[model samples]
Structures are given as C-alpha cells and as structure tokens.
Target chain A: MCGIVGYLDKVGTEGGNVGSVLLGMLTALACRGPDSTGVAVFGQHRPDELIAQIKLGENGNGTEYARKIEETGKEFGGREFSQTSAYLRFVFTETNDLHAFITRVEATGDPVEVVSVGRRLEIVKQVGSPSRLEKTFGISAFQGKHGIGHTRLSTESVVDLSHSQPFWGHGYPDLAIVHNGHITNYHQLRRRYEQRGTRFYTENDSEVVAVFLVDKLQQGRGLHTAIESIVRELDGSFSCLVATDSALAFVKDAFSFKPLVFAETDDFVAVATEEVAIRNAIPGDFTVREAQAKEVRVWSR
Target chain B: MVEIDAAGRTTREVNRAIRQRIAESCKEVVLRNPGARHNLAVAILEDAHIRIAGSAGYYCGGLIDGPSIEVEGSAGWGLAESMLSGTVRVHGSAGSGAAAAVRGGTVVIHGDAAARLGVSMKGGIVIVAGNCGYMAGFMAQKGTLIVCGNAGEAFADSMYATVCYVGGEIANLGTDAVIAPIDAGEAQQLEKILSTHLPATLRSTKPAAADFKKVVAGRKLWNFDKREWRTWQEAL
Candidate 1:
C-alpha cells in the first residue's frame, strides 16, 4: 500500500509555498510507504512542458547519464536537461511525441521513469525516506498553486527509483497519477497496452493504471469522464489522484476498500489516503470527511 | 518537570514540539487539559512517563514501548492497538477495540470497555474493572483478561493461549472457550498483578467481591474430526 495527497485551489494564491504543505503531508504518511517519496509542484511559469524525474546510477555517473539523456532529447525534440547525484530534471518540448521518445530512452540499460507532468508541474522524487527526498531534491524549494505527492511502499515491486510514483501518463503533459492499492488485472492490462506499442518500466500494477488513465484522457476524454471510465473498467481496490494541467481529480474503486479522506474549504481543497495526511497538509481547524464509495470528484483552477 | 500546555496549538505544532522535547531533554512530561488538544501524544513519548489530564482520541499510546502512560479520562477506539510493551491506564471508559493486537505490556481500564477488547492479542495482561461488550478477547493467542464485572457474551471466541477471568455472569463462551476454576496459586498470582497495575482506589476493594471465573481454550479446535460412519449408524 501507498499514500497519495493532492491540494488545489479555486480562488486565492495557490502558488505560495505548497511544497512545504505537500512535504508535510508526505511526512505524515511516511509510515504507509517507507520505500520512496516524490512530489510534483505545479508552478506559475510556462505550463506546457512537464518535468520528468529520472534517476541514474549512484556510481558518480548521474550527471554523465543526465547529459547523455539530455543529448538524447534531441532525438525526440526535448531540451533543458539538468542533472544531480541520482536526480535528473528535464523539460520535454514535443509533448505529442513524448511517448516515442520515452520508448527510445527505455531501450537503454539505465532505468528511467516520468514521475509527473502538468502545466508547470515539476516532479521531485528519490529513493529512501520522505525526509531523504526532501533533503536530496530540495522538494520544498518549488512553489506552485497546487500539486500531488506520493510515498511508496514496495509491496509487489522491487524498491527502485523506476517503480516510484506518481507516474506521469507517458507522453501526456500535465497528467500524473498516484495510487493507493494493487491492480489485480495488471498482467492483462500490460499485455494489451504493450501490444499497442506502450513500453512499461516497472512491475508495479500502479503503472498500468497510470497508462490506462492517460490513454483515456489522450483519446479526447475529459478528466472526470476518463476517471469514471477507468473506475468502472479497472478491477481491484484502489484510490487514485490524477492531475492534469488545469484539473485535479480523485477516483475510488468500486469496493472502496482503501481509505481516502478529503477536506474542502473556500480557499483550498485537499485529499489524502488518510485523514492524518489532510490534517498535516493544511494545518487548520477543518472537518475532514471520508470519500464516498465509487465517487469521482474533480477540482480545477 | 516540563509542563507543555498544548491548548490552542495545532496538532502538527504540538506533536512537533512534544516530539522534539522528548528527543532532547525530557524523561517525564505532563500535559494539562489534553482532551482539548486533539493529536496523538503517547505515540511520540515512548519510554517516558507521560500523564494526560483529560481524555484522549483514537490510538492513545498505540504501539507504545517501555513508557508508562496514564490517561486521566477516557480513551477512544483502538487504544494501545498493537502496543509492544509498557503500561497504559485509562481512568474512564474505553471505546471499541481497545488494545487490539497487543504483543506485550499491561492495560488497565478502571471503567467499562467496549467490544473486541484484546482482539488478536499475542501476549499481555488486560484488566477491565467494569463490564465488557461482546466478543471480548476474540482470537487472543497468548494473554490474560480479567473482567471485574459481568462479561457480555461470546467471551474468548476463537481463543487460543489467552486466559480470561470473569467475576460476574457470562452471556456465552464462543467456540472452544471453556470455564475453569481459579486455584489458590492462580488467585495469588492475580492478586500480585492487580496490586502492581491497579490504582489504590480500585485495589482497596475486597478481592472476594471480584473473585473471578477463569476461561481458557479447550484446544479441541486444533485437531480434525476423524469419526467413522459406524459411530453414526450405532447412534441411529
């Protein structure tokens, strides 16, 4: 099991230090998933290009691998690839051709995954504790209007950077997914998606959900419609947070076995796997309510 | 003698400050009017003598270890759930599922406890001064529950190693739970344990009034039935 939290605002300045709020929420949920932590902050600047978080080897080749990927960006028309020790942040220019570009990159030996993407949405993630992610990526540095974050516990998949969430809908800008439960039908879905030329990097079932939702959204479905469609088709107990460039959506599985709580106010809206996460993210006296079964709620700024 | 008034502070700030103090320089801490502050406290104060003046929300002293915690008021659901070690005392009533999955330590509720007390307890001692709701001591593998008052019903359903002592009437004993007489030696051991964990107000009461009827698993559920068809034909 994992924990997912997201916050969006309709009025007021949503762009103020939301990174701290996201980090605080992730910290509250650290016990749910201790393997890795990640956060995506939607900044106010250029909203077209999405930030892809990639982790290279720890043998001092992080920067070199990032430069190599940056150079490879020329193949699919990407730019501005930056590198750190085991961290890579780059902007993809050709959003439409991002799927093809990601496919080519995964053919290489090095592991890579699109952690999050959105209009001005920058994803920061790393292996280890939530505190480690904050320390390594300076996740609190990014300020945005609203964002989604995740803390991963490796129940089914190996504990690697590639399997960490929230996974970006491959090639889709301003689209990201964070899941809470296992997808039992992952093998079937993976076969179908793979046959259609979709490349998968991790053995996690959550990645299939991300790809499925993105496929729906890219095929001319709205965020709410796409989420509702997946909720009906997907089998398993899951609660997910999907974010687009201008929208934030939550979808609970049919059974609603997994826990999800939300607190909405006039100023901001928050959702988390547990009520404690919502309390940690927005520190105020507010009534937290549990999400209804099979409910799909959406918020857009 | 560090007294932290958590009143008017957000749960986060209170938790952060209390955790910091516990980490830095505090062995014993006291919180005045803790009921007004709604955050998890005993969770952070492991191995410390922490006293709460008022009631606590869910999970008071949950997963506690080494620390001796006392709550002056009642406790919400799942009190001491999965508690590993140490002692937790609730002066008033406890909500449902108190001490669920406790591995060790002792929990004493001066008042009544709701349903599912000591559920799945691996080992420990839980003493309820008052009556308990239904399904008390369900799935208890290794532990002891002493109910000074009447036990509701279905006591020790699916119980294994745990022993239950009921002072008053028992509605029912589910599955393999069987009532056994408390001998002189067992009574002496119970008295000793009660003296250590119970408060003076409760300990002063006459032991005869609280004389308990011990309940334990019969161990019959572990084996499979292998009776032949001839036995059924003879009975017919």
Candidate 2:
C-alpha cells in the first residue's frame, strides 16, 4: 500500500501556504508507506516549460548520469537541467516537442521518460524517508499553488527509485500520477502500449495506469472524461490521483479496493488515502468524505 | 484514589483527569463512580494501577502500557484496541470487537463479549468469563484467549499463532482450525492466570480444569493451490 495526496485551491488564489499543507498531509500518511517520499510542486512560476523528474540506476555514478541527462536536455533544446541523488530534473524550453525528446531519450542506452512537465510544474523526488526527502530537496521551500505527493511501499515492484510512483504521462506536460493498489491487467495494457511505439522503463504495474491515462488525454479527451473512461476499463482495485499544471483529478476503481478520502471547502480541496492526512493538512474544521467507487473528480485552480 | 463525580463533569474531563493522574504516578489509581456516566478513556496509564467504577465508552484504557484497568461495568466497542501492554479487567459484558488489534497485555472480561473478539490480535492474553460472539480471534497473528463459557461459531479463522481455550461447547471452528485436548502444563498455566485475574466470586466454584479445549490453526492452508477443485475440497 502507498499514500497519495493531491491539493487544489480553486478561485486562483496564491497566498495560502502550499508547502506547509504538503508537509502536514505527508505527515498524516507517514504510516501508510514509511520507506520513501516525493513531491511535485506546480508553483506560481512560469507555467510554459515542462519539468521532468527522472530516477537513474542506484549505486551508479550520480554526476556522470546527470551529465548525460544534461546532454540530452541540450539536444532537446531544454535549458537548466539539475541533478539530485540519482534524480534528474530538466526544464524544457519547448514543451511542444516533448514527445520528440521522450522518443530521443528512449533511444539512448538507459531507460528515460518525462516524469512531469507543465507550466509552473516542478517534480522533487528522492529515495528516503519523507522528512529526509524534504530536507534534501528543500521541499519546504517549494512554494506552489497546487501539487501532488506520494509515499511508496513497494508491493508489486522493487524498492528502486525508478519504480516509485507519480509517473509522468507521455506527451502530457505537468501530468503526473500517484496510485495505491494493483493493476491486475498491467501486462496486457503494457503490451498494447509497447506496440504503439511506447517504451517502458520499469516493470511496475502502476506505469500502465499513467500510460493509459496519457493515451486518452492525447486522443483529445478532457481530463475528467479520460479519467472516467479508464476507471471503467482499468482492472483491479486502485485509488489514483493525477495532476497537471491547471487541473487535479482523483479516480477510484470500480471495486474500490483501496481507500481515498477528501475534504473540500471553499478555499481548498484536499485528497488523501486516509482521513488523518486531510486533518493534518488543513487545521480548520472540515467534513471528510470517502470517494465513491468508480468516481472521477477533477479540480482546477 | 481519584473520586470523579460524574454528576456534573463531562466524560472528557473525567477521562482527562484519570489519564493525567495515571501518566504522573505509578501508584494504584482507583476511579470512583464507574457507572456514573459514559466516558472514553484513552492511554489512561502507561504503567500504573487503574480501577473504573462504571461503564466505559469506546476505547476504554486503550494502549495501556504496564498498568491495570478494571472496569466495573460493561465496555463499548474496540475495547483495548492496539494496546501495547498492561492488563484490562471488565466486570460486565463487553460490546462488539473486544480487544481488537491488541498488541500485548492481558484483557479479562467477567461477562460475555460480542462478535469479533481479539480480531487481528498480534499478541496478548484475553480471558472471558462468559460466552463469546462469532468470529472470535479472526485472523489472529498471536495471543491466547481463554473462554470459560461457550464460544460462538467461526472461531479462529485464518489464525496464525494464537491459542484459544474454550471451556464449553464450540459452535464451529473456521477454516484450517482444529480442537485439541489441553495438557496438564497448559492447565496449570491457565490455573495460574485464573488465580491472578479472576475475582474470588467467580473463582470460588471453578469448573474442572481438565475440561478445557485448545484450538489451533493447521499449516496446510499456507500453500497456493493450482486447481480450484483441490482448493475447494481441501478447504471443506
């Protein structure tokens, strides 16, 4: 089991401290998955470029791997590539040609994919405790209006950084996914996506969900419709959260094997795996309700 | 001794006072007026002596460390939920899910307990003076539950390391569960436990110690069966 939290503040308001909210939410869900934590902040910065979070192989040379990623960024016309603990965050100047960059990166030796990209979107992830990840990445300093957080407990996949969730959708900037539960039909879906010129980096079942949702979004479907379509098609139990620069959506599988609770007020909307997370995130009194089975809810600020 | 008058004080205040006293002292803390009102006492004591005069609401003496809590009246649901250590004694009946998920300690119920007693228990000792409800000790990882009276059906389902002692008839044992005769050593252990926790009124006319039965889980259920028919037949 894993913990997922997504926050969206409607009404286009900015001053409402997002970093503190992420900290509180993550703290509440610390018991769900205590191994590693990650956060992606869609800040109030320039929302034109896409930020990709890539996790390379562990026990390898961090600097050498980062240099290779920086070279790849340069080739794809992206500027300002940064590295942190086996992770690479690249800022793409031309978000329109991300598909070409993804394809070109896949052609390289090591497996690489865009983890998240969108206007004002920046993904910060690491391989440690939530507090450790926050301390290393300065997640507390990430000032954003909306974002998604994940705490992973490896069930179907290994505990490597590449298998960590909040996987980015191909050709979808600022679109990242976090899931809790197994995808029983992941191999079938992976095969179909692979046939369509899509390459996978890890053997995690959760990646199929990201690919499936991204496929729908690329087919000109709205975020909510795409989520609803997948909720009916995706097999097994899952409660997932998807985020882009402007939109945040949550979807529960038809059987609703996983747990997801949401607390909504006029100021903000918070989603988490447990009610304790919502309470920790927002101090004010609010009613927390469980998301219905097969329900797809979308929020945008 | 703490004399909490529930005449006007809220249940929360009474519980808080008791909790504060338990946290501060190692001496025996007696709570007067156990039946005065409904209250939920959580983390009442880490390591002290506690006595309640009346019924306790949800989660009475929850997560007790080394202290002993004696409830004069019945207890509500989730009694002793996730208790790490200590002992809880209920003079009256216990509502559903008694001792649910208790990690360690000893819970003695003088009266009957409702369904799902000791569900998912990791480790502990539970003694019920009267009958027990259905699905007792379901999915129990480890612990011991001694029932002086009849145990409801479907007891010890998916049980791992827990040992169940039922003095009277068993309605039914769940999948992979079986009943075995209690040995002399085990009987002596139960006698020692009964002497320590059982009140004089109930212990005076104790039944024959050799009549108790033990319930255990068979290890055959751990394997994954390829054929559905084989699985169903073995389960039956």
Listed models, DockQ each: 0.04, 0.03
Tens-digit per-residue lDDT, B49-165, candidate 1: 778766665688887777877877666667888888888898877766788999999999988776678989999899988778767898899988888887766788877899888
Interface RMSD of 1: 9.0
lDDT of 1 by residue, A180-227 (tens): 998888999999999998878779899898889878876998788889
Candidate 1's displacement at residue A187, Å, is: 1.8
> Could you list the CA RMSD of all candidates, in the order they appear?
11.1, 12.6
- Residue range with the least summed lDDT across 10 consecutive positions in model 1 chain A: A284-293
How far is B22's C-alpha from truth in model 2 (Å)? 11
Q: Give the clashing residue pairs of candidate 1, or none.
A: A14-A145, A118-A174
